[model samples]
Target: MWGKSTAAVFLGMPLSVLVVGFAALLSHDQASTTLPWLLLFFLVWIAVMTCTFLFRTGLRAWLWMGGLTIAGYAALHFLKASGLVRIAA
Candidate 1:
């Protein structure tokens, strides 16, 4: 369905980024982060894409994934701001 496809492309992308970014933040070994995160992004993205179809409608998919992505990003931001987690540049 077109709705699922759009959700997979739009919502899934940012959600994957947030997942990988948070994971990378938690990792203390920043030296070897990039490659692993790159790999993780694909895995997370595939999972997210598949999960989108579980919703009954495209709008539902967008709402849930969007909300989830927002929540995850907020938590990630909080952790970074509180100095509980940090990503090495």
Candidate 2:
């Protein structure tokens, strides 16, 4: 539980950001949409944390979360390079 809790606290935050980023990118990416994601971020973070505990072990949680974050960043870069979305970063 300690490992899982740590993973959830540490990894889950970035995963939630990536998820929100993905949503924002796929959406209209305007000021009007900002509030919705701001509201939804905590929900997504909580969901990711909850889902982490469903993994078989702490290592799995960390591995999967890390892998997912990497994949998410890759996808973000791909989208940016592909010129599909205009990312400030």
Candidate 3:
């Protein structure tokens, strides 16, 4: 099960990378470039998740997943504050 899940992640990360690459090429904007960076981040995440599956317990996996979530939220917050995105009242 662990092997299967890890392989799934390894395979899936490249698809995400491709999607982001296509997106970056399809759009001509600063935001588009940054969008690919987000994909790269996720690729790293998938790799981490796959690797952490080897642990006896899933503590590191949980921590890394939680940390990624927080980091994503923080990125959104900063992007909104910087006027890259608008927050609706």
Candidate 4:
């Protein structure tokens, strides 16, 4: 239990940030879209934390979450490089 909680704090939290950051990068930049995306961010965070306990070991959880975080950021970078997504200056 403590291990899972620790993983949630150390690994899952960063994973959720990467997830939310990727989502925001893909979302429309209008101010009207901000609230919904913020809500989605919280939901994604909770879901990631909840899923952290599914792994049999804390190490496995860390590995999976780290992989996801890397994948999310990589996809975002790819999209930006490919001109599929753009950020305002």
For each candidate, C-alpha RMSD in Å?
1.7, 2.1, 7.7, 2.3
Task: Report, for every candidate in turn, its global Cα lDDT versus the true structure.
Answer: 0.85, 0.88, 0.53, 0.77
Across 4-81, the per-residue lDDT of candidate 4 in tens digits comes to 788788777678777666666666773566567667887888898999999999878778887887887788778879
Arrange candidates by lDDT, descending. Answer: 2, 1, 4, 3
Model 1: per-residue Cα lDDT over 32-72, one tens digit each: 98678888788888998998898898888888888998999
Error of 1 at 78 (Å): 1.2
Report lDDT (Cα) of residue 50, candidate 2. Answer: 98
Error of 2 at 4 (Å): 0.9
lDDT at position 14, candidate 1: 94
Using Cα atoms with residue i matched to residue i, what is each candidate's TM-score against the true structure?
0.82, 0.88, 0.37, 0.74
lDDT string for model 2 (1-89, tens) is 88799999999999999998888767765566766987899999999999999998899999999999999999899988999888443
Candidate 3: residue 16 Cα off by (Å) = 8.4
Candidates 3 and 4 compared: the better one by TM-score is: 4
Candidates 2 and 4 compared by TM-score, better number: 2
Which candidate should be chosen as best, given TM-score against the real structure?
A: 2
Global local distance difference test of model 3:
0.53
Residues 35-89 of candidate 3 have per-residue lDDT tens digits of 5567576766566556656645545444554455456557656765788654222
| Backbone clash pairs in model 1 (N, Cα, C under 3 Å; residues 3+ apart or in different chains), count | 0
TM-score, structure 2 vs. true: 0.88
